[model samples]
Target: MNGAQDLGGMMGFGPVVPEPETLRFHADWEKRALAVTLAAGAMGVWNIDTMRHTRESLPPAEYLSASYYEIWAKALANQLLADGLVSREELREGHAQEPPRPVPRVLQAADVAKTLAAGTQYERAAEAPAAFARGATVRTKVFHPTHHTRLPRYARGKRGVVEAVRGVFVFPDTNAHRQGEHPQWLYTVRFTGPELWGEGADPGLTVSIDAWESYLEAA
Candidate 1:
């Protein structure tokens, strides 16, 4: 899962320059690209995690070369083709070659406002008590998963203090792969800069990352 998208703390990419707050869509087509991706997603062929994995799974060169919406558009196409919602020929021809496939639901124009406002609820009731408590010292487990994982490479195998319990939620590691939601306790784990980036890192710098319980262990 280590890909070009996980650029945190990575050097040689040059510093990230800030964009103007007023800037939204770089081009008119980008807006349509987002709308199409969202509308297709509303059809429920795949979950958000699956869409994310598709985007992340893009070849390193392709992923790096694409813009934000370009990634979304490419990933959407991949999903459509994989799900049989559209054929490669149809994609190439820009027309349907087969009968329309039934989806779980359709997003109507009027429903867009409410659907976007309501959002998807991921926080589920806990099946058990949280494993770690506030202020507990813990270490992130070193893992190299073949599927999607929310745990970034930088924070792995590092020690941190629990700052907050973020409640149970769908565990993306399994959910993204269509294994199951397999929800786990979420926590805000705060790591000192030195613990992650070594002694030469800024002494005053620290990072708080939302880590699933499975990613952490008692130190």
Candidate 2:
């Protein structure tokens, strides 16, 4: 899904301004937003890919205007509504109008530390041999999927060399749609700036992206 969130090589936006001191949250509500998102995620109603897709699926205008945490909050709300976890009226009133649905898993405060330490891992056992090896040239498939995809728009159809085999990992394209892990080989592909952007791009600049096997083909 092409959206404002995929601002990889696009122009017009000013240079990124880094904060003097990196704080986790800029405001109190942002903290709460993170907490709510984490808590809701514990229910296992959706995968991390689905959550990301929801965030990226926001309207271009709204996504551009929203802050970082605001996007998370909005995405969380959308998931809750879509999954039947909450009702539109309930969201509007800020109170439950009906009985709450029972969730299979709940995140207790006592388990927060352990849960945070054991983050979600996407890597899985290799199901088959890798199609391409290190130093092999490959091209990313030009695609505009309506569902979730990790491949960025700028790199589509571009040729790059496989730099490293990062092992098999759950394919986000299928995982987000509840189509199973569908694990595939992952690799770090290196591309010159000129290949991605126009020839005017800095020749000294090179970019590396971790691409799934499904997104690439032998060049």
How much lDDT does each candidate structure score? 0.92, 0.92
TM-score of each: 0.97, 0.97
**What tens digits encode model 2's per-residue C-alpha lDDT throughout 1-219?**
887788887778787888767666778998899899999998889999999999999999999889988999999999999999899999999998999898889999999999999989989998689999999999999999888898999999999999999999999999998899999999999999999987699999999899999899999
Q: Ten consecutive residues with minimal summed lDDT in candidate 2?
A: 18-27
Deviation in Å, model 2, residue 44 alpha carbon: 1.1
Give one digit per residue, the lDDT tens place, for model 1 in 1-219. Answer: 987778778778767799999999889999999899999989877898988999999998999889889999999999898888899999999998899988899999999999999999889899999999999999999998878988889999999999999999998888888999999999999999999999699999999899999999999
Error of 2 at 154 (Å): 0.4
- Error (Å) of candidate 2 at residue 127 is 1.9
